[model samples]
Every structure is written in C-alpha cells, then in structure tokens.
Target: MELSVTAVILTLTAILCLYYWNNRGRRSRLPPGPPALPLIGNSLHIDKRAPDRSLIQLGRKYGPVFTIWLGPRPAVVLCGYKAVKEALVDQADDFGARGTIPSISKVTNGYGIASSNGPRSRQLRSFAITALGHRGNGTSTLEGFVQQEAETLVEAFTKTQELPFDPTFRLTCATANIMCAVVFGCRFDHTDPKLLALLHMMDENMKVISSPWGQLYDLLPNLLDCLPGPHNRLFENANKIKSFLREMIQLHKDTHREGTPRDFIESFLAKMDEEKGNPRSEFNDENLLLSTFNIFLAGTDTTGSTMRWGLLIFLKYPEVQEKIQSEIDREIGMDRTPCMGDREKMPYTNAAIHEIQRYANIIPLNLPHTVTRDTEFRGFLIPKGMLVIPLLSSVLYDPSCWETPKSFNINHFLDERGQLKHKDAFLPFSIGNRMCIGEKVAEMQLFIFLTTLLQKFTFRSPVEPSAIDISPLSSGFSTLHHPYQLYCIPRRPARRPASE
Candidate 1:
C-alpha cells in the first residue's frame, strides 16, 4: 500500500513539473496578459461577453502589440495603426497564415482564401485578384455590374413609398442581392427560401462565434467536438450552405457556356477546367464552393450591417445628412439615380461616407493571421505559426490619425479646398497582399446606395431616439447593431432638386 501511494505521488509530481515548465517559459517570453489559471490560459479573460472592449483594456495595460492565449494557443494582437500597419503590411510575407480553429477547419476543410495558408493562400489570392481584374479598381466591368446592382437597390427602396418604414430588411435585401448578382448572376427577393436559409446560416455561424459556447468551443476544441450545442447547430448549418454550393457548382458544370463566362461562378469554373490537370491547381469545386461561401457571407453581412449603421448615423447627425443630400442633389439631380461615377463629383457626400467608415470602425481586428516562418518584429523573436491579429479599429479611430476620433466628423477626410483627402490610416478595407478582395465593390455599393437613398428619403430618428442603442452588440465574430428600427420618410424630389 505504501509503495503504491509513493508511485501515485511521483506520477502527480512529474505531471505538475511538465505543466509548470511548459507554461513558465511561455509566460516569461510573451508580453503581459490577463493571468491564466492552470491549463486554461486566459480563457476567462477572453470570454464571449464584450471581447473587443476586454481586448482594448488588456491592450491598455500591455503594449499595443501583446500576446494572449486562446486556451493553449498563443495569439499575438497588434493594436493601434502603427502596430497593425507594421504587422499586416510591413511584415506581410511573415504573417500570411490563418488559424484553423475547429469550427473553421470543419467548415472550410483547410481550404478557402479567408482560412488557408502557404501556397494555397497565394494561389487563392492570385486567382481572386486576377478574376477581379488587375487594373484600376480591378475591372470596369465590375464597376458597371455594381452600378446595375445599385440601380436595383434604388428601385427597391423607392417602392417603400412615402410612409415611415424600417430600412433594415430592405437594405439586407439590396445587399444580399448584390452578392447574388456578383456570384450566381442572379438576385433573390426577400422571401426566397434558399436566400432565407443562407441568411439564417450566416446568423447562426456568427452567433456561435460570439456566444459563451463559442468561447468554450475554442478553449476546449477537442472536448467540445463531442458535445451538443448551438456551435454544432451552426456547423450543421454551414454544411447545409456547403451542400447548396455543391449543387450550384454542379449546375455551373452542366450548363456552362464555352468561351463566354457569364458570372463569377462561370469564370471560376472555366479557370478550374483550365488548371485541372496542373499539379499546383487548387482551383477545384471545393475551393470554388468555399470562395463562393466566403463572398456571400463576407459581402452581404458586412455591407448590410454598415448600411444599417449608416442610416442610424444619418438619423443622429441631421446636419451631415442634409449636407450630403444637398451634395447629392447638386451632382445627381432629382429623378436620377446616383452612379459609381457620381461619387467623384460629390465631395462632401464622399467625405461623409469615408467618415462613416472611420467612425464605425467595424471588424475591430481583422481575421487573424499566422506567421509563415520564423521572423523578427523589433528585435522580438516571433516563431513560426504564431498568430498575428491586426486591430483595424485602432487605425480607424486613432487619435493621432484623426482630429476627432470618436465624434462624427466628416472634415477628417476633407481639406480646406473642400476636396476629399485620403489618409494613410484610413484602412477600413485593410492593406497588403491579404487585403479584402471585394473592397472596391463594397465602397461603390456603400456610396451609390447611401447617396441614392438619401436623395430620395430623409431618415428620421423615431420619438425617444435615445432609447435606440447606437452602440453595437457583441455578435461573436463581428460587432453588430441591436435589432433597432428607423423611420424613413420619403422626401419630395422637387423639394431637394438641383435648382435649389
């Protein structure tokens, strides 16, 4: 009995020694972060509730660039403009990898541009840039396509009539329609069964990322895999979306027109055929499906959320909205829908849009990247596969970069001559090789749609506007508005005519 107890004690001592040794070295080398308990390093510090604010506070105590662990995994966060720019741009080659979280890994299967690494990432990036076109704002064809989508959006909004109506669903319809046109060369009405299913899946996916269950899943990925929760439901929904993508891929293959690609899927399908026999070819049906999936989720949700916020911003700042409407009236006139080209002529309106992007500062830290190889950041040794987080919100709201970082100021993007000024810190779309692919399209959509809507309607805050929470809700993956409604009143086009 004595010998058995001694053996048990020895085994426990060895395990304790191993744990301390591994964790002690990590603690000393990395920047200061919230204290971790035993095996769950900083998991409590990074719980789902208000992660962005928690991270910001942690950033305040630690330097702008510091490391935090998601359970056992070490994640290096780059806060502020300089840190983010330096890491994401200056050290672009070093930090080009994506983390394969259990949820993402299961969903993407180690493919797709947003969640891949190495040669595959490079191939995806290159193919996407090429497909999008390589010149000014990529292709003029894309701009024309975006403009057509904008016209559709304007027409949709116009159909809402003169009564006070909420623009959320309508804006979502328009935004999702743009994605539809871009991807499958089609648009779905707000009631389409397939579109609604996709939307629910998107919501579920994002919800899983921001929930406590999501935190638990990330912290205990292996254990969580066998459990039942919303995370699993989200995964199931993701599979449903993937199945839809496969159906679309098969449809594209069956009905493909030779030498005359009609849409994004067609172009991609043709490219896959061209590179089918090549050894380095990553352009397969799976890649195409994931890419389509990424575009749909990224394109629709982010833009739709921004427009919703845009309406709220206008409701808050009536003067800014009035000025923008004046500029739109002078440029596009009554009865004419604004085009992508109209943005260049409407300086104040353009500046306001830029200001909206800056102030909103959505996607606080962009998608996390991993170090491709062993690298150095200011004499600090960053080992291979270390996670690098680029905090874009810091750049957008950097006091050094803007006169009033927190307030709604349009002059930040405008000079004394009333012309729009570009700031290097204005990286809403991010910078470098891993920069967002659909930025130009997104910008064009925001400008045309917002300007067109403002020209036709005057958005008013409902009675007791302060009751509305302009502050964003923590939606796991992204910062989203609490489901709030706004009153959109149609303005007589004659009252805001160009002659005025």
Candidate 2:
C-alpha cells in the first residue's frame, strides 16, 4: 500500500513538471499573455459574450501584440492600428493565410475561401473576384439591379405609412437580391418564403456562431461534437443552406449552356468542365456549392447588418440623418436617383457613411489570419500555423488613429472644409490580400441604397433619440445590432407629406 501511494505521487509530480515545461516553451516562442490553464487554456479568462472586447482589454495590459491560448491553440492577437497594420499590411505575405475556425470549417468542410488555405483558396478566390467583376450578357449592370432594388425597398418602406416597423426583412431581401442576381441569375420576391427562411437561418447562425457556444466549438470542437447545444444549430443551418444552394446548382446545371456562362454559378460550372481531367483541379460541385455559400452568406449578412446598423445610427442621431439627407437633396436633387458619381461630390453624406461604418465596426474580430511560416513581428516571433487575430475593433476605435474614437462623429471622416477625409484606419472591410473582396460592390450598394432611402424618407426613431440604444446586442465575429423599430416619413419624390 505504501509503495503504491508513493508511485502515484511520483507520477503526479512528473505530469505537472512536463505540463509546466511544455507551457513555458510555448510562451517563450509566442508573445506573452495572461496565465492560461491546461486543456481549457484561456476560455475562462475571456468574456464569452464579447471575446473581442476581452481581447482588446488584454491588449491594454499586454501591449499591442499579445498571445492567448484558445483551448490548446495559441493565437497571436494584433491590437490597435499600428500592430494590425504592421502584421497585416507591412508583413502582408506572412500574415495573409486564413486560419481555421472549427465552427466554420465543419460547415464549409475546409472547401471555400472562408476556410480554405494555400492553393485551393488562391484558385477559388481568384475565380470569385473575376466572376463578381463579370457582367452577364443579357442582364443589367449590378448598379442597375441595385437601383431597382432600392426602388423596391422604397415601395416596401412606403407601405409602413410612418408607423413602427422592423427593417430587417426588407433590408435583407434588398441587399441579398444583388448577390442572388449575381450567383443565381435571378431575384426572389420580397415575400418569397424560401428567401425569408434562408435569411432567418443565416441571421441565427451568425448569432450562434458569434456566441460563446460558437467560440467553445471552435476551441474544443472534438469535445463539443458529441454534446448537444445551440452551437449544433449552425451545422443544421449549414445543411439547409447547402440544400438550398444545391437545388439552385441543379437547376443551373440543367439550364446552363456550355461556353457562354450567364451567372456566377454557370461561370463556375464552366470552369469545372474545363478542369475535368486535371487531378488537382479545385473546380467541382463541392467547391461550387461552398463558394456560392460563402459568397451568398457573406454578401447577404455583412451588408445587411451594416445597413441595419446604419438605420439604427440614423435613428439615434437625427441630425446626422438630416445632414446626410440635406447633402443628398443638394447634390443628387430629390428628383434623381443617387449614383456612384454623386458620391465623390457629396462630402457630408460621404463622411456620414464612412463614420457609420467606422462606428458600426462590423466584423470587429476579423476572420482569423494564420502565419504559414515562422514570422518575426514587432520583436516577437509568431510560430508557423499559429492563429492571428487582427482586432479591427481596436483599429476603428483606436484613440491614436481617430480624433473621436468612442463617438459616432462624422467629423472623424470630415475635414475643416467639410470634405470627406479618408483615414488609413477606416478598414471595416479589413486590410491585406485576404480582406473582404466585396469592398467596391458593398460601397456602391451602401451609397445608392442609403442615398435613395434618405432621398425618399426622413427616418424617425420610435423612441426618444436619447433612449435609442445603438450599442450592439453582442460583439464578436460580428456585431449584431439590437432589434428596434423606426418610423419613416416620406420626403419629396417618394410621396406627399402624410399630413398633407
């Protein structure tokens, strides 16, 4: 009995020593951070509800660049404008690779750009950017489609008659319809049941994926795989979106002719046929489904969420909205639809939109980046395959970068002459080669959609402007604005005054 007890004690001591040395070696190789426990690592330390905020706070204590263990995985987080710019901008090639989030990877099966790495990602992303840039022979320009959707949105808002209504559905359909036209060569009616359900799934999936549950699934995927929770719903939603896209693909397969590609999907299908005999060809049905999924999901949610946040900000600061409206009316006139050309001329409206994006800080914790090689950055060496997070919230809200980092001030993007001032840190689409590919497209949609809305309606908050809570419900991978209703009073070209 005495010998057995001594052996057990010796074994425990050995295990502890091994764990200590292992962690010590890791810390020596990575940037220093808060002490993390074995297995769970820093999970307990992070505010699950707002991991990005927690990471930002740690950035305060640990300097601009620091390391944290997510489960057993160590991630190097680049905070503020300088650190993020250094790694993602100065050392772009080193930090350009995409990192795996288990939650997203499982759904994507490591297939698309969102989760793909190396050659596959390069091939797919190149095709995607080119495809997005192309115009279908018989279709209207993307701008024309957006303008038409803006008119449809106008019709939808006018139906509310200055009463309280949630803009989520209409905004979603409008923004998503652009991508729908690009990918599927068609648009869904505002009342389409399938579109509505797909949007509902996407919205919830984003919520759950940004939630603590989603973080855990990313951190400890294998352990959580057998467990039951809302995190599992993401996979279910993925499958549903898969079925939806698969059906769309099948329809395209039947209708799409060889050589002459009509839509994004057909373009991809054409590529797939070209690469049929090549063993390394990444063009296949799986890639097609996932690439489309990534395009559609991303194309829909980020812009949709940004627009919602934009409207929410408008409700909070009526002056900002009025000023933008005044600028729109002055530049574009209440008669003509707002155009991209008008953007260069409308300084205040341009500043307001830029400020809105900065204030909104969508994708606060940018999709994680990876170092494919051992990289030395800012006096610290990041190991190859280590996950890196370019904390965009830090950059957008960095005091050193923005004059009024904490406030929703248009002056952040404005000069004394009231001209739009471009800040190097205004990167809601993030920076580097891996940045959001839809930047220009999103910019046009935002300018047209917003200017069109303000041209037609003066939006009013349901609550007192003082009571309007523009703070997001949760902040992580995405900042989800709290659901709120607002009233829309028509302007000149839309309709006569409600009272008149």
Candidate 3:
C-alpha cells in the first residue's frame, strides 16, 4: 500500500511538472538561461550549498541578466555590479516587490517586513526604520548601550586569558544584547536561560536557512513539509521564537503607557492602537510580533557573524589588525571607548571595517525581490510575481568595479593617499527600497564592537595566519566563516584609566 501510494504521488508530481514545462514557453521575451528539466527545473545544474557561485558561473554564460527556474517558477537574476545596480538601484520601483519564498513564508506567515509586500511591507519598513532609528539614535543612549556591551565582551575575552577559545557565543551575546535593548527595551544577562535559548534558536535558524537543506525546503516546501527533516525543526524553532514574541507583546500591552513609547515594541503597539479601526491598517498584533521577530533575528545574525568574521580576519592578518590598533591609539586612545564619531578621523580603521563587510559578503544572495508589476527591464519582459535576485555577491566581487575583488584588501575602500574612499558597489546590506532595514544599527555595531576589541586586545590564532582558511564553511542565504579558535591578548593601556 505504501509503495502504491508513493508511485501515485510520483505520477502526480510528474504530471504537474509536465504541465509547467509545457506552459513555460508561453511567456515571451523572458531573460535567457540554461535549459531546465521537468519538475526539478535547474535544481540539478545548480549547487545548493553555494548557489551564488553557481549563479555567478551561469551569469558568465547567460550574460548578467538571465533567468533560472527554481522549480516550476522562473527567477530572473541580475548579476555583476552593473546588472544588480540597474535592477535594484536604478530601476528600483520595478523590482521593489518581495518574492514569496516558501521557507520564509512558512515562518513569517506572509507577514512582517522580510516577506510582506505592497502597502504592508512599505508601512512596516518605514515604521521600523523610524522606530529603530529612534531607539538606536547613534549618539548617547545607543552608543552607551553598545560600549557597555563591548566592555562586557572584552571582559569575557579577558577571562580566556591567552587560551584559544571560540568567541561565537560572546560575540553573539553582545550583538543580541544590542538588539534586545533596541527592540525589547532591555538587555539579557549572559546567563539568562531564556536569552540563551533565544540565541540558540536564532543561531539554529540561521544555520538551517543557510544550509543546503534549508534551500531544499525553500525550493520544495510542500514535499519537504510531508517528509521528516531539519525543515520541520526550522519551523518549530520559528514557532518558539514567535511564541516568545507573542508573550512579550502581551506583556507590553499590559504595561504600555500611551504617549510614552519605550522601544520598538511600544512604538509599534502605539501605532497598532492608533490604526485599530482602519480596515486597511497593517498595524496589528501579528505584524508587531513578526516585525519584532524580523528585527531581532536580522539584527543578531548579520552583525554577530560579521564581527566573528572580523576577528577571524584579524587573526589571519595581524598587520591589518596592528594598523587599525595604531590608528585607534593615535586618535581615540585606550582611555575612551570608540564611538561612531571617531570613525571619521580613523580612515584606515574605517576602511578595514568596510573591507571586512565586503570580504564577508554575508548575505551573498540577498533577500529575493519580485516584480511589482509586469515590467520591461533591460530589453527583456519580466512578468509580475517573478522571483528576482539582485546577486549581491556578483556586485561586491565584480571584477570591473573593485581594484581587487577577490582578495581581502582594504585598499578597495582606500584612495592612493590612504584616505577612506567610498565604493558604490559595496551592497552587503543590499540596495534601494528593500535593502536591509537594520543597516545603520549593523554598521554601528560592527564599527564599535570591532574597534573596541582591537583597542583592548591583539588577536592571534593557534595556527599560522597563512594557514587559516578565510573562505566560508557554508554558503546559501549567507556566507559563514569556518569556526576557528583564537587567542585574545590584552594590550597595555597608553592613557590614564577612566572611572568605571
């Protein structure tokens, strides 16, 4: 009976694929791509683990702007700096819509800024940016919170005391605390059970999302939904986070004071109450919960991973670390903590941080975008609802754009005079309307946390710097550096100590 059921299911799947295959040619003037097979489409041809690499190779053959069918659905990929810029930046409106990614949709339930489109997405995104900015004003309060966390982080590293140790949890905790302060209006104790669980869930979700299994779940969610796999755990983890958020929302509602918004949640709750009667209002408990989830999750992973990568890179390149430390010593000195304002005077340190982001290329295949309407783009006719990916890896590593795209050279962001220079192609947070909502917060975190560490310690790895592998261990939604232990040796102070 089981065999018969399996056979029937396969037959139905084959028929559906045939139907999609037959209708595929009906769409006219679609971007060019490699020929795809029935049911699987280009799944066989592409590398699930490193889809960006596969897509980059495909871009070379099919030109910068081309199509590749994920399953039955065809996605138009804008590759290289020029192509991605044209679509995401120059032609922003046409490609502003968010694609219905099954994996994210399942978790987000078609709500929140990451998955929502049209008015809802716009409303939430705008409100989120405003709320996040208000919370993370980058001046007094936010900087204080970050600097405090950096001190805690330095303390944690000092505990290691020249012993090689993994800095993942310490880094993640520091980063997550910043998010907690911004979103939840508080910070989590390093030993808090709930906070630890939350961080674990966030880390697991990130790993799963960036895993090949995660891509498979996204590609064939329905089938994978039925089968037993890690995807199920992914959904379960999302529910746990959502449940936590829901509980927090209720607590906020119970304690919320009108006209006195504490943080992102209070501000959103206020909006939800204001728009309570409007039928078209996107502000609600569901959105508030999911939007909070989106911010917390996004805020934690990207910044945490980047900082971890920065430390690893520092261990890999001690000379670069020394350069940044010297700049910090000369400009700010050890008595005072590094702040965003100091980023202006420290060109080499600024360039190194930018280089870390560019080299990290964390989110290589940025959040998938879609066509707002049936639009004509770059001599090709892209229909509405088509999945559009502005390959950020292509842009960040485009040979024509950077002096040395492949290498981790800070000179890419430095002029001949060794002053900081801006490169238009640095889109690690992506570009235009749907770019990362937490870009500013992430930037602040990276600059402050990294500079703080550099000021406090000189990092060295167990193995020789040249032996360290800078290439990511995994690459799907994001590129994660291979886990490695490093020694954090505290630097002697050059200035008088300030009062704690």
Residues 404-432 of candidate 3: C-alpha lDDT, one tens digit per residue: 88889999999989999989988888888
List residue ranges in candidate 3 displaced over 4 A.
1-26, 494-500
Poorest 10 consecutive residues of model 1 by lDDT?
Answer: 132-141
In terms of TM-score, the best-performing candidate is 3
Residue-level lDDT of model 1, residues 1-500, one tens digit each, is 99999998899779867877876654456555666564576877763766766676688888887888777677777778888788877888887677566667778888887887778888887877666552116245555655666666666666766455677667777778777777787777778898888887776777777688876786788888888877788688888988887887788788998886666788888888888889988888778889888887788888887888888888777888889888877788867767767878988988888887777766776777788887778656667777777777667877778898878788998999999998999987888778888887688779878887787778776645556566666635666766655656677756445784
lDDT for model 2, on a 0 to 1 scale?
0.87
- lDDT for 385 in candidate 3 is 80
The residue ranges of model 2 lying beyond 4 angstroms of the native Cα positions read 1-26, 135-140, 493-500
- Candidates 1 and 3 compared: the better one by lDDT is 3
Each candidate structure's TM-score, on Cα atoms with residue i matched to residue i, is 0.91, 0.93, 0.95
Backbone steric clashes in candidate 1, count: 1
lDDT of each: 0.76, 0.87, 0.88
Model 2 per-residue lDDT tens digits across residues 437-486: 77777888888999999999999986899998888788967888888999
What lDDT would candidate 1 get against the real structure?
A: 0.76
